[model samples]
Target: MLWRGRRQSDNVEDERSDTGGSGGFGGGSPGQFRIPIGGRTGGGSSIFIVILVVLAGWYFGFDPSQILGGGDSGGQITDDSGSEGGGAGAPASDEMKQFVSTVLAETEDTWKGIFQANGLTYEDPKLVLFSSQIRSACGFASAAAGPFYCPGDHKVYLDMTFFQQLDQQFGASGEFARAYVIAHEVGHHVQNLTGILPKFNNMRQGMSEADANHMSMQVELQADCFAGVWAHYTAQKGILEQGDIESALNAAKQIGDDTLQKKMQGYVVPESFNHGTSQQRQTWLARGYKSGKLSDCDTFNNPI
Candidate 1:
């Protein structure tokens, strides 16, 4: 993909180099088995998280407020062990950061146009680039959790190290592959805007874990399709190169929930798939890419 000279988003907040001492949640154990790593602030911060989740739920039409307040607030950031050095990474990480910001800006442009065409206002979302750990409306998350979109904060959280992992470990080495991951998360933000997220949350209540997982798969597949739609527009704009689609497909294949499960546990559990199969992901993405239409990505209506 040719992304140089493109507009970069100002909504990004970089917190990679900042470091602090280790602190644990001060609140008494919430009966959780795992030890708390991020520091817990007063109950007010927890309440703030709750409020954010409630707002997001109202915006998305789902009651996701329950997912908030599950942890402490204003937690201390862990040491920046995996963060890029200022002097060393200043040259390389800056470039990566710029690239990500540019991609995010482009996503905003594409989504804005789509929303306008559909007679809706587009709300721009923020993307945070962090290293090691960060606090979000979804509570504290480590880099190990990968890139996630927290509806509560309307922000996408990413660790650039994941791109390296995508290349070296997952065998998805292309820059477009990395862009695909960001687009997928941004696609979730799109669902939030379109009221699909709240509906899914409502349907998930009291459902069996398997049934919920199936619904989750549909949601993920739809996001992949949205990414394809973005790809379609980019291709039309001549921003996408010949092998960019292949890289994206390779990424979709590499991160399929079934494939990841099989690789990690030496087995696959279809019932627990939250992100669809490799073939399903690749097919849905390709469908959107080929059709260049949002109507083509109705995974909830079509059988997998």
Candidate 2:
């Protein structure tokens, strides 16, 4: 990966300190509600917690309103923050934090160039580093639900522990694999900027559960392709070592919905697959890596 010693992003928010003051989880203006950290309340804390729970539920295939005891919680949820352990918090090491910041800066550089070439301005997104649980513009989330980008806030929420899980649980070790995860989430931010996410969400509104899942698969696959696009640029800069691409491909395969479902339930259900199969993920990522063109990432129109 060769990420160390590179420029680190100033857009990173280190909420791991847990010293209070909104935690800067999503980098947005203060909202009405905020999460109660350690029984603390006020200053818009309760709403953040509600939003985090809802967002986490959405990632884990559940309705936030249902999980939060119906839709009566009048406030709009936003942003994220959290600690480590089963809920106990811990700060991320300086090396890991620096590594993430470096990766994020590279992605910013890559995307900014690509967007400029396409006659579009690139907006840098803030990356939030949290522990066990965090709040986001889309809602709250835990490390268990994996990394995600909140379109509402245009920020990427990451729980560093997910890197450990990626290695120990998914067997997708290596710096490139970790980079792929960050890139994939940043890809979602790109989608938000390009209006793909809003359009997809609108389309999914009237869809059946199976149909919505299919739409989500396209969205996720496109993000994977975007990640590969970033990788293509990095490779051209001669920063990628041998086997770097393979590590990313292995990661894509390991996180496929089919593979995860089989690992969890001993079976695969195609209808419920929102993130595509292992082969599809690897193939789309490869397509972007080979072509290095945004036009090549039209997962919705093209067959996977």
Candidate 3:
């Protein structure tokens, strides 16, 4: 990805200098994450995580709004998130800052076009850059939870160190892979604007755990698809280099619930999967990349 010299978004809130103090995130142990399950408790892990692992079930797609303000840890499903450096991420260098800002700007441009074409307005969501931990309207979160979009505050939060983790820990590298991560969270902002997220959030309260997980899968997969749509238009700008799409696809595959579960434990519990499987994620992303059409990303309507 030839991202240098690109326009950087002014909407970014660089709070790295503030360094929000440490506190227990979601009341879970630091450097690890817990998946909240309703009316279910086992040996303190997901059936998919008994061997001990989880991505917050949302590395790139974790929406803190769902977990925020939900009381009690009796159903906490804990796992090692490879986040053991303990919330103290070094500040994002100027170069990294520029890259992220550029990616955000690109996403802003792409979504604006799509929304305008459909006779709607597009709102550019703010992206917050933080170190270690930060307080959000969705609640307090650590970088270990990975980058997430908070509909409560209409902001995307990040710890730039996650890009290094994505490459070294998850075996997903390349600039476009990082871009896809940013785009996916921004996609959540799009869903929030178009009422998809609001609908899911309202309905999930009444849904069974399994049914809610299924719905969450649709929401997350659509975000992945939206990321691909961003990539589709990005390619037209003549900045994409060879192997860019493959890197993004690999990033999607790496964070899929099934793939991460297998990589951590050895098997998968399809019922506990909130994000789509590796194949499903890749398929949706590829579909959107191929068509560049929001119509192709109806995970709720199509068999995914």
Q: Evaluated with lDDT, which candidate comes out highest?
A: 3
TM-score of 2: 0.76
* Candidate 2 global lDDT: 0.66
- lDDT scores for all predictions? 0.66, 0.66, 0.69
TM agreement with the true structure for every prediction: 0.77, 0.76, 0.78
Question: Residue 245: error of model 2 in Å?
Answer: 0.6
For TM-score, candidate 2 versus 3, the one ahead is 3
Off by over 4 Å in 2: 19-93
Give the C-alpha miss distance for residue 123 in model 2, angstroms: 0.7
lDDT of 1 at 194: 70
For model 3, what is the error of residue 38's alpha carbon versus the real structure, in angstroms, after optimal superposition? 18
Q: Rank the candidate models, highest lDDT first.
A: 3, 1, 2
> Clashes in candidate 2: how many?
22
Evaluate candidate 2 by giving its C-alpha RMSD to the native, one decimal: 14.8
Residue-level lDDT tens digits of model 3 in 1-304: 9877555666789999776766644632211111111122111111222111211222223322232112222111211222211123322447888788878877876676555544567888999999988887777877777888888888998898998888998889999999998998898898788766666665666667777677777778888998887787777667789999999999888888877777767877877787777798899999888866666776765776
Write the residue-wise lDDT of candidate 1 on 1-304 in tens digits.
Answer: 8987655666687878754123563322111111111111111000112213432422322211122111221110111223222433332346898788778867876776666544467797888888877777656666766787877678888888999988887788888998888898899898877766666665566576766666677778888998997777767666778899999999899787677777677787666667777899899999888866666776765787
**Cα distance off (Å), candidate 1, residue 40:** 28
Q: Rank the candidates by TM-score, best first.
A: 3, 1, 2
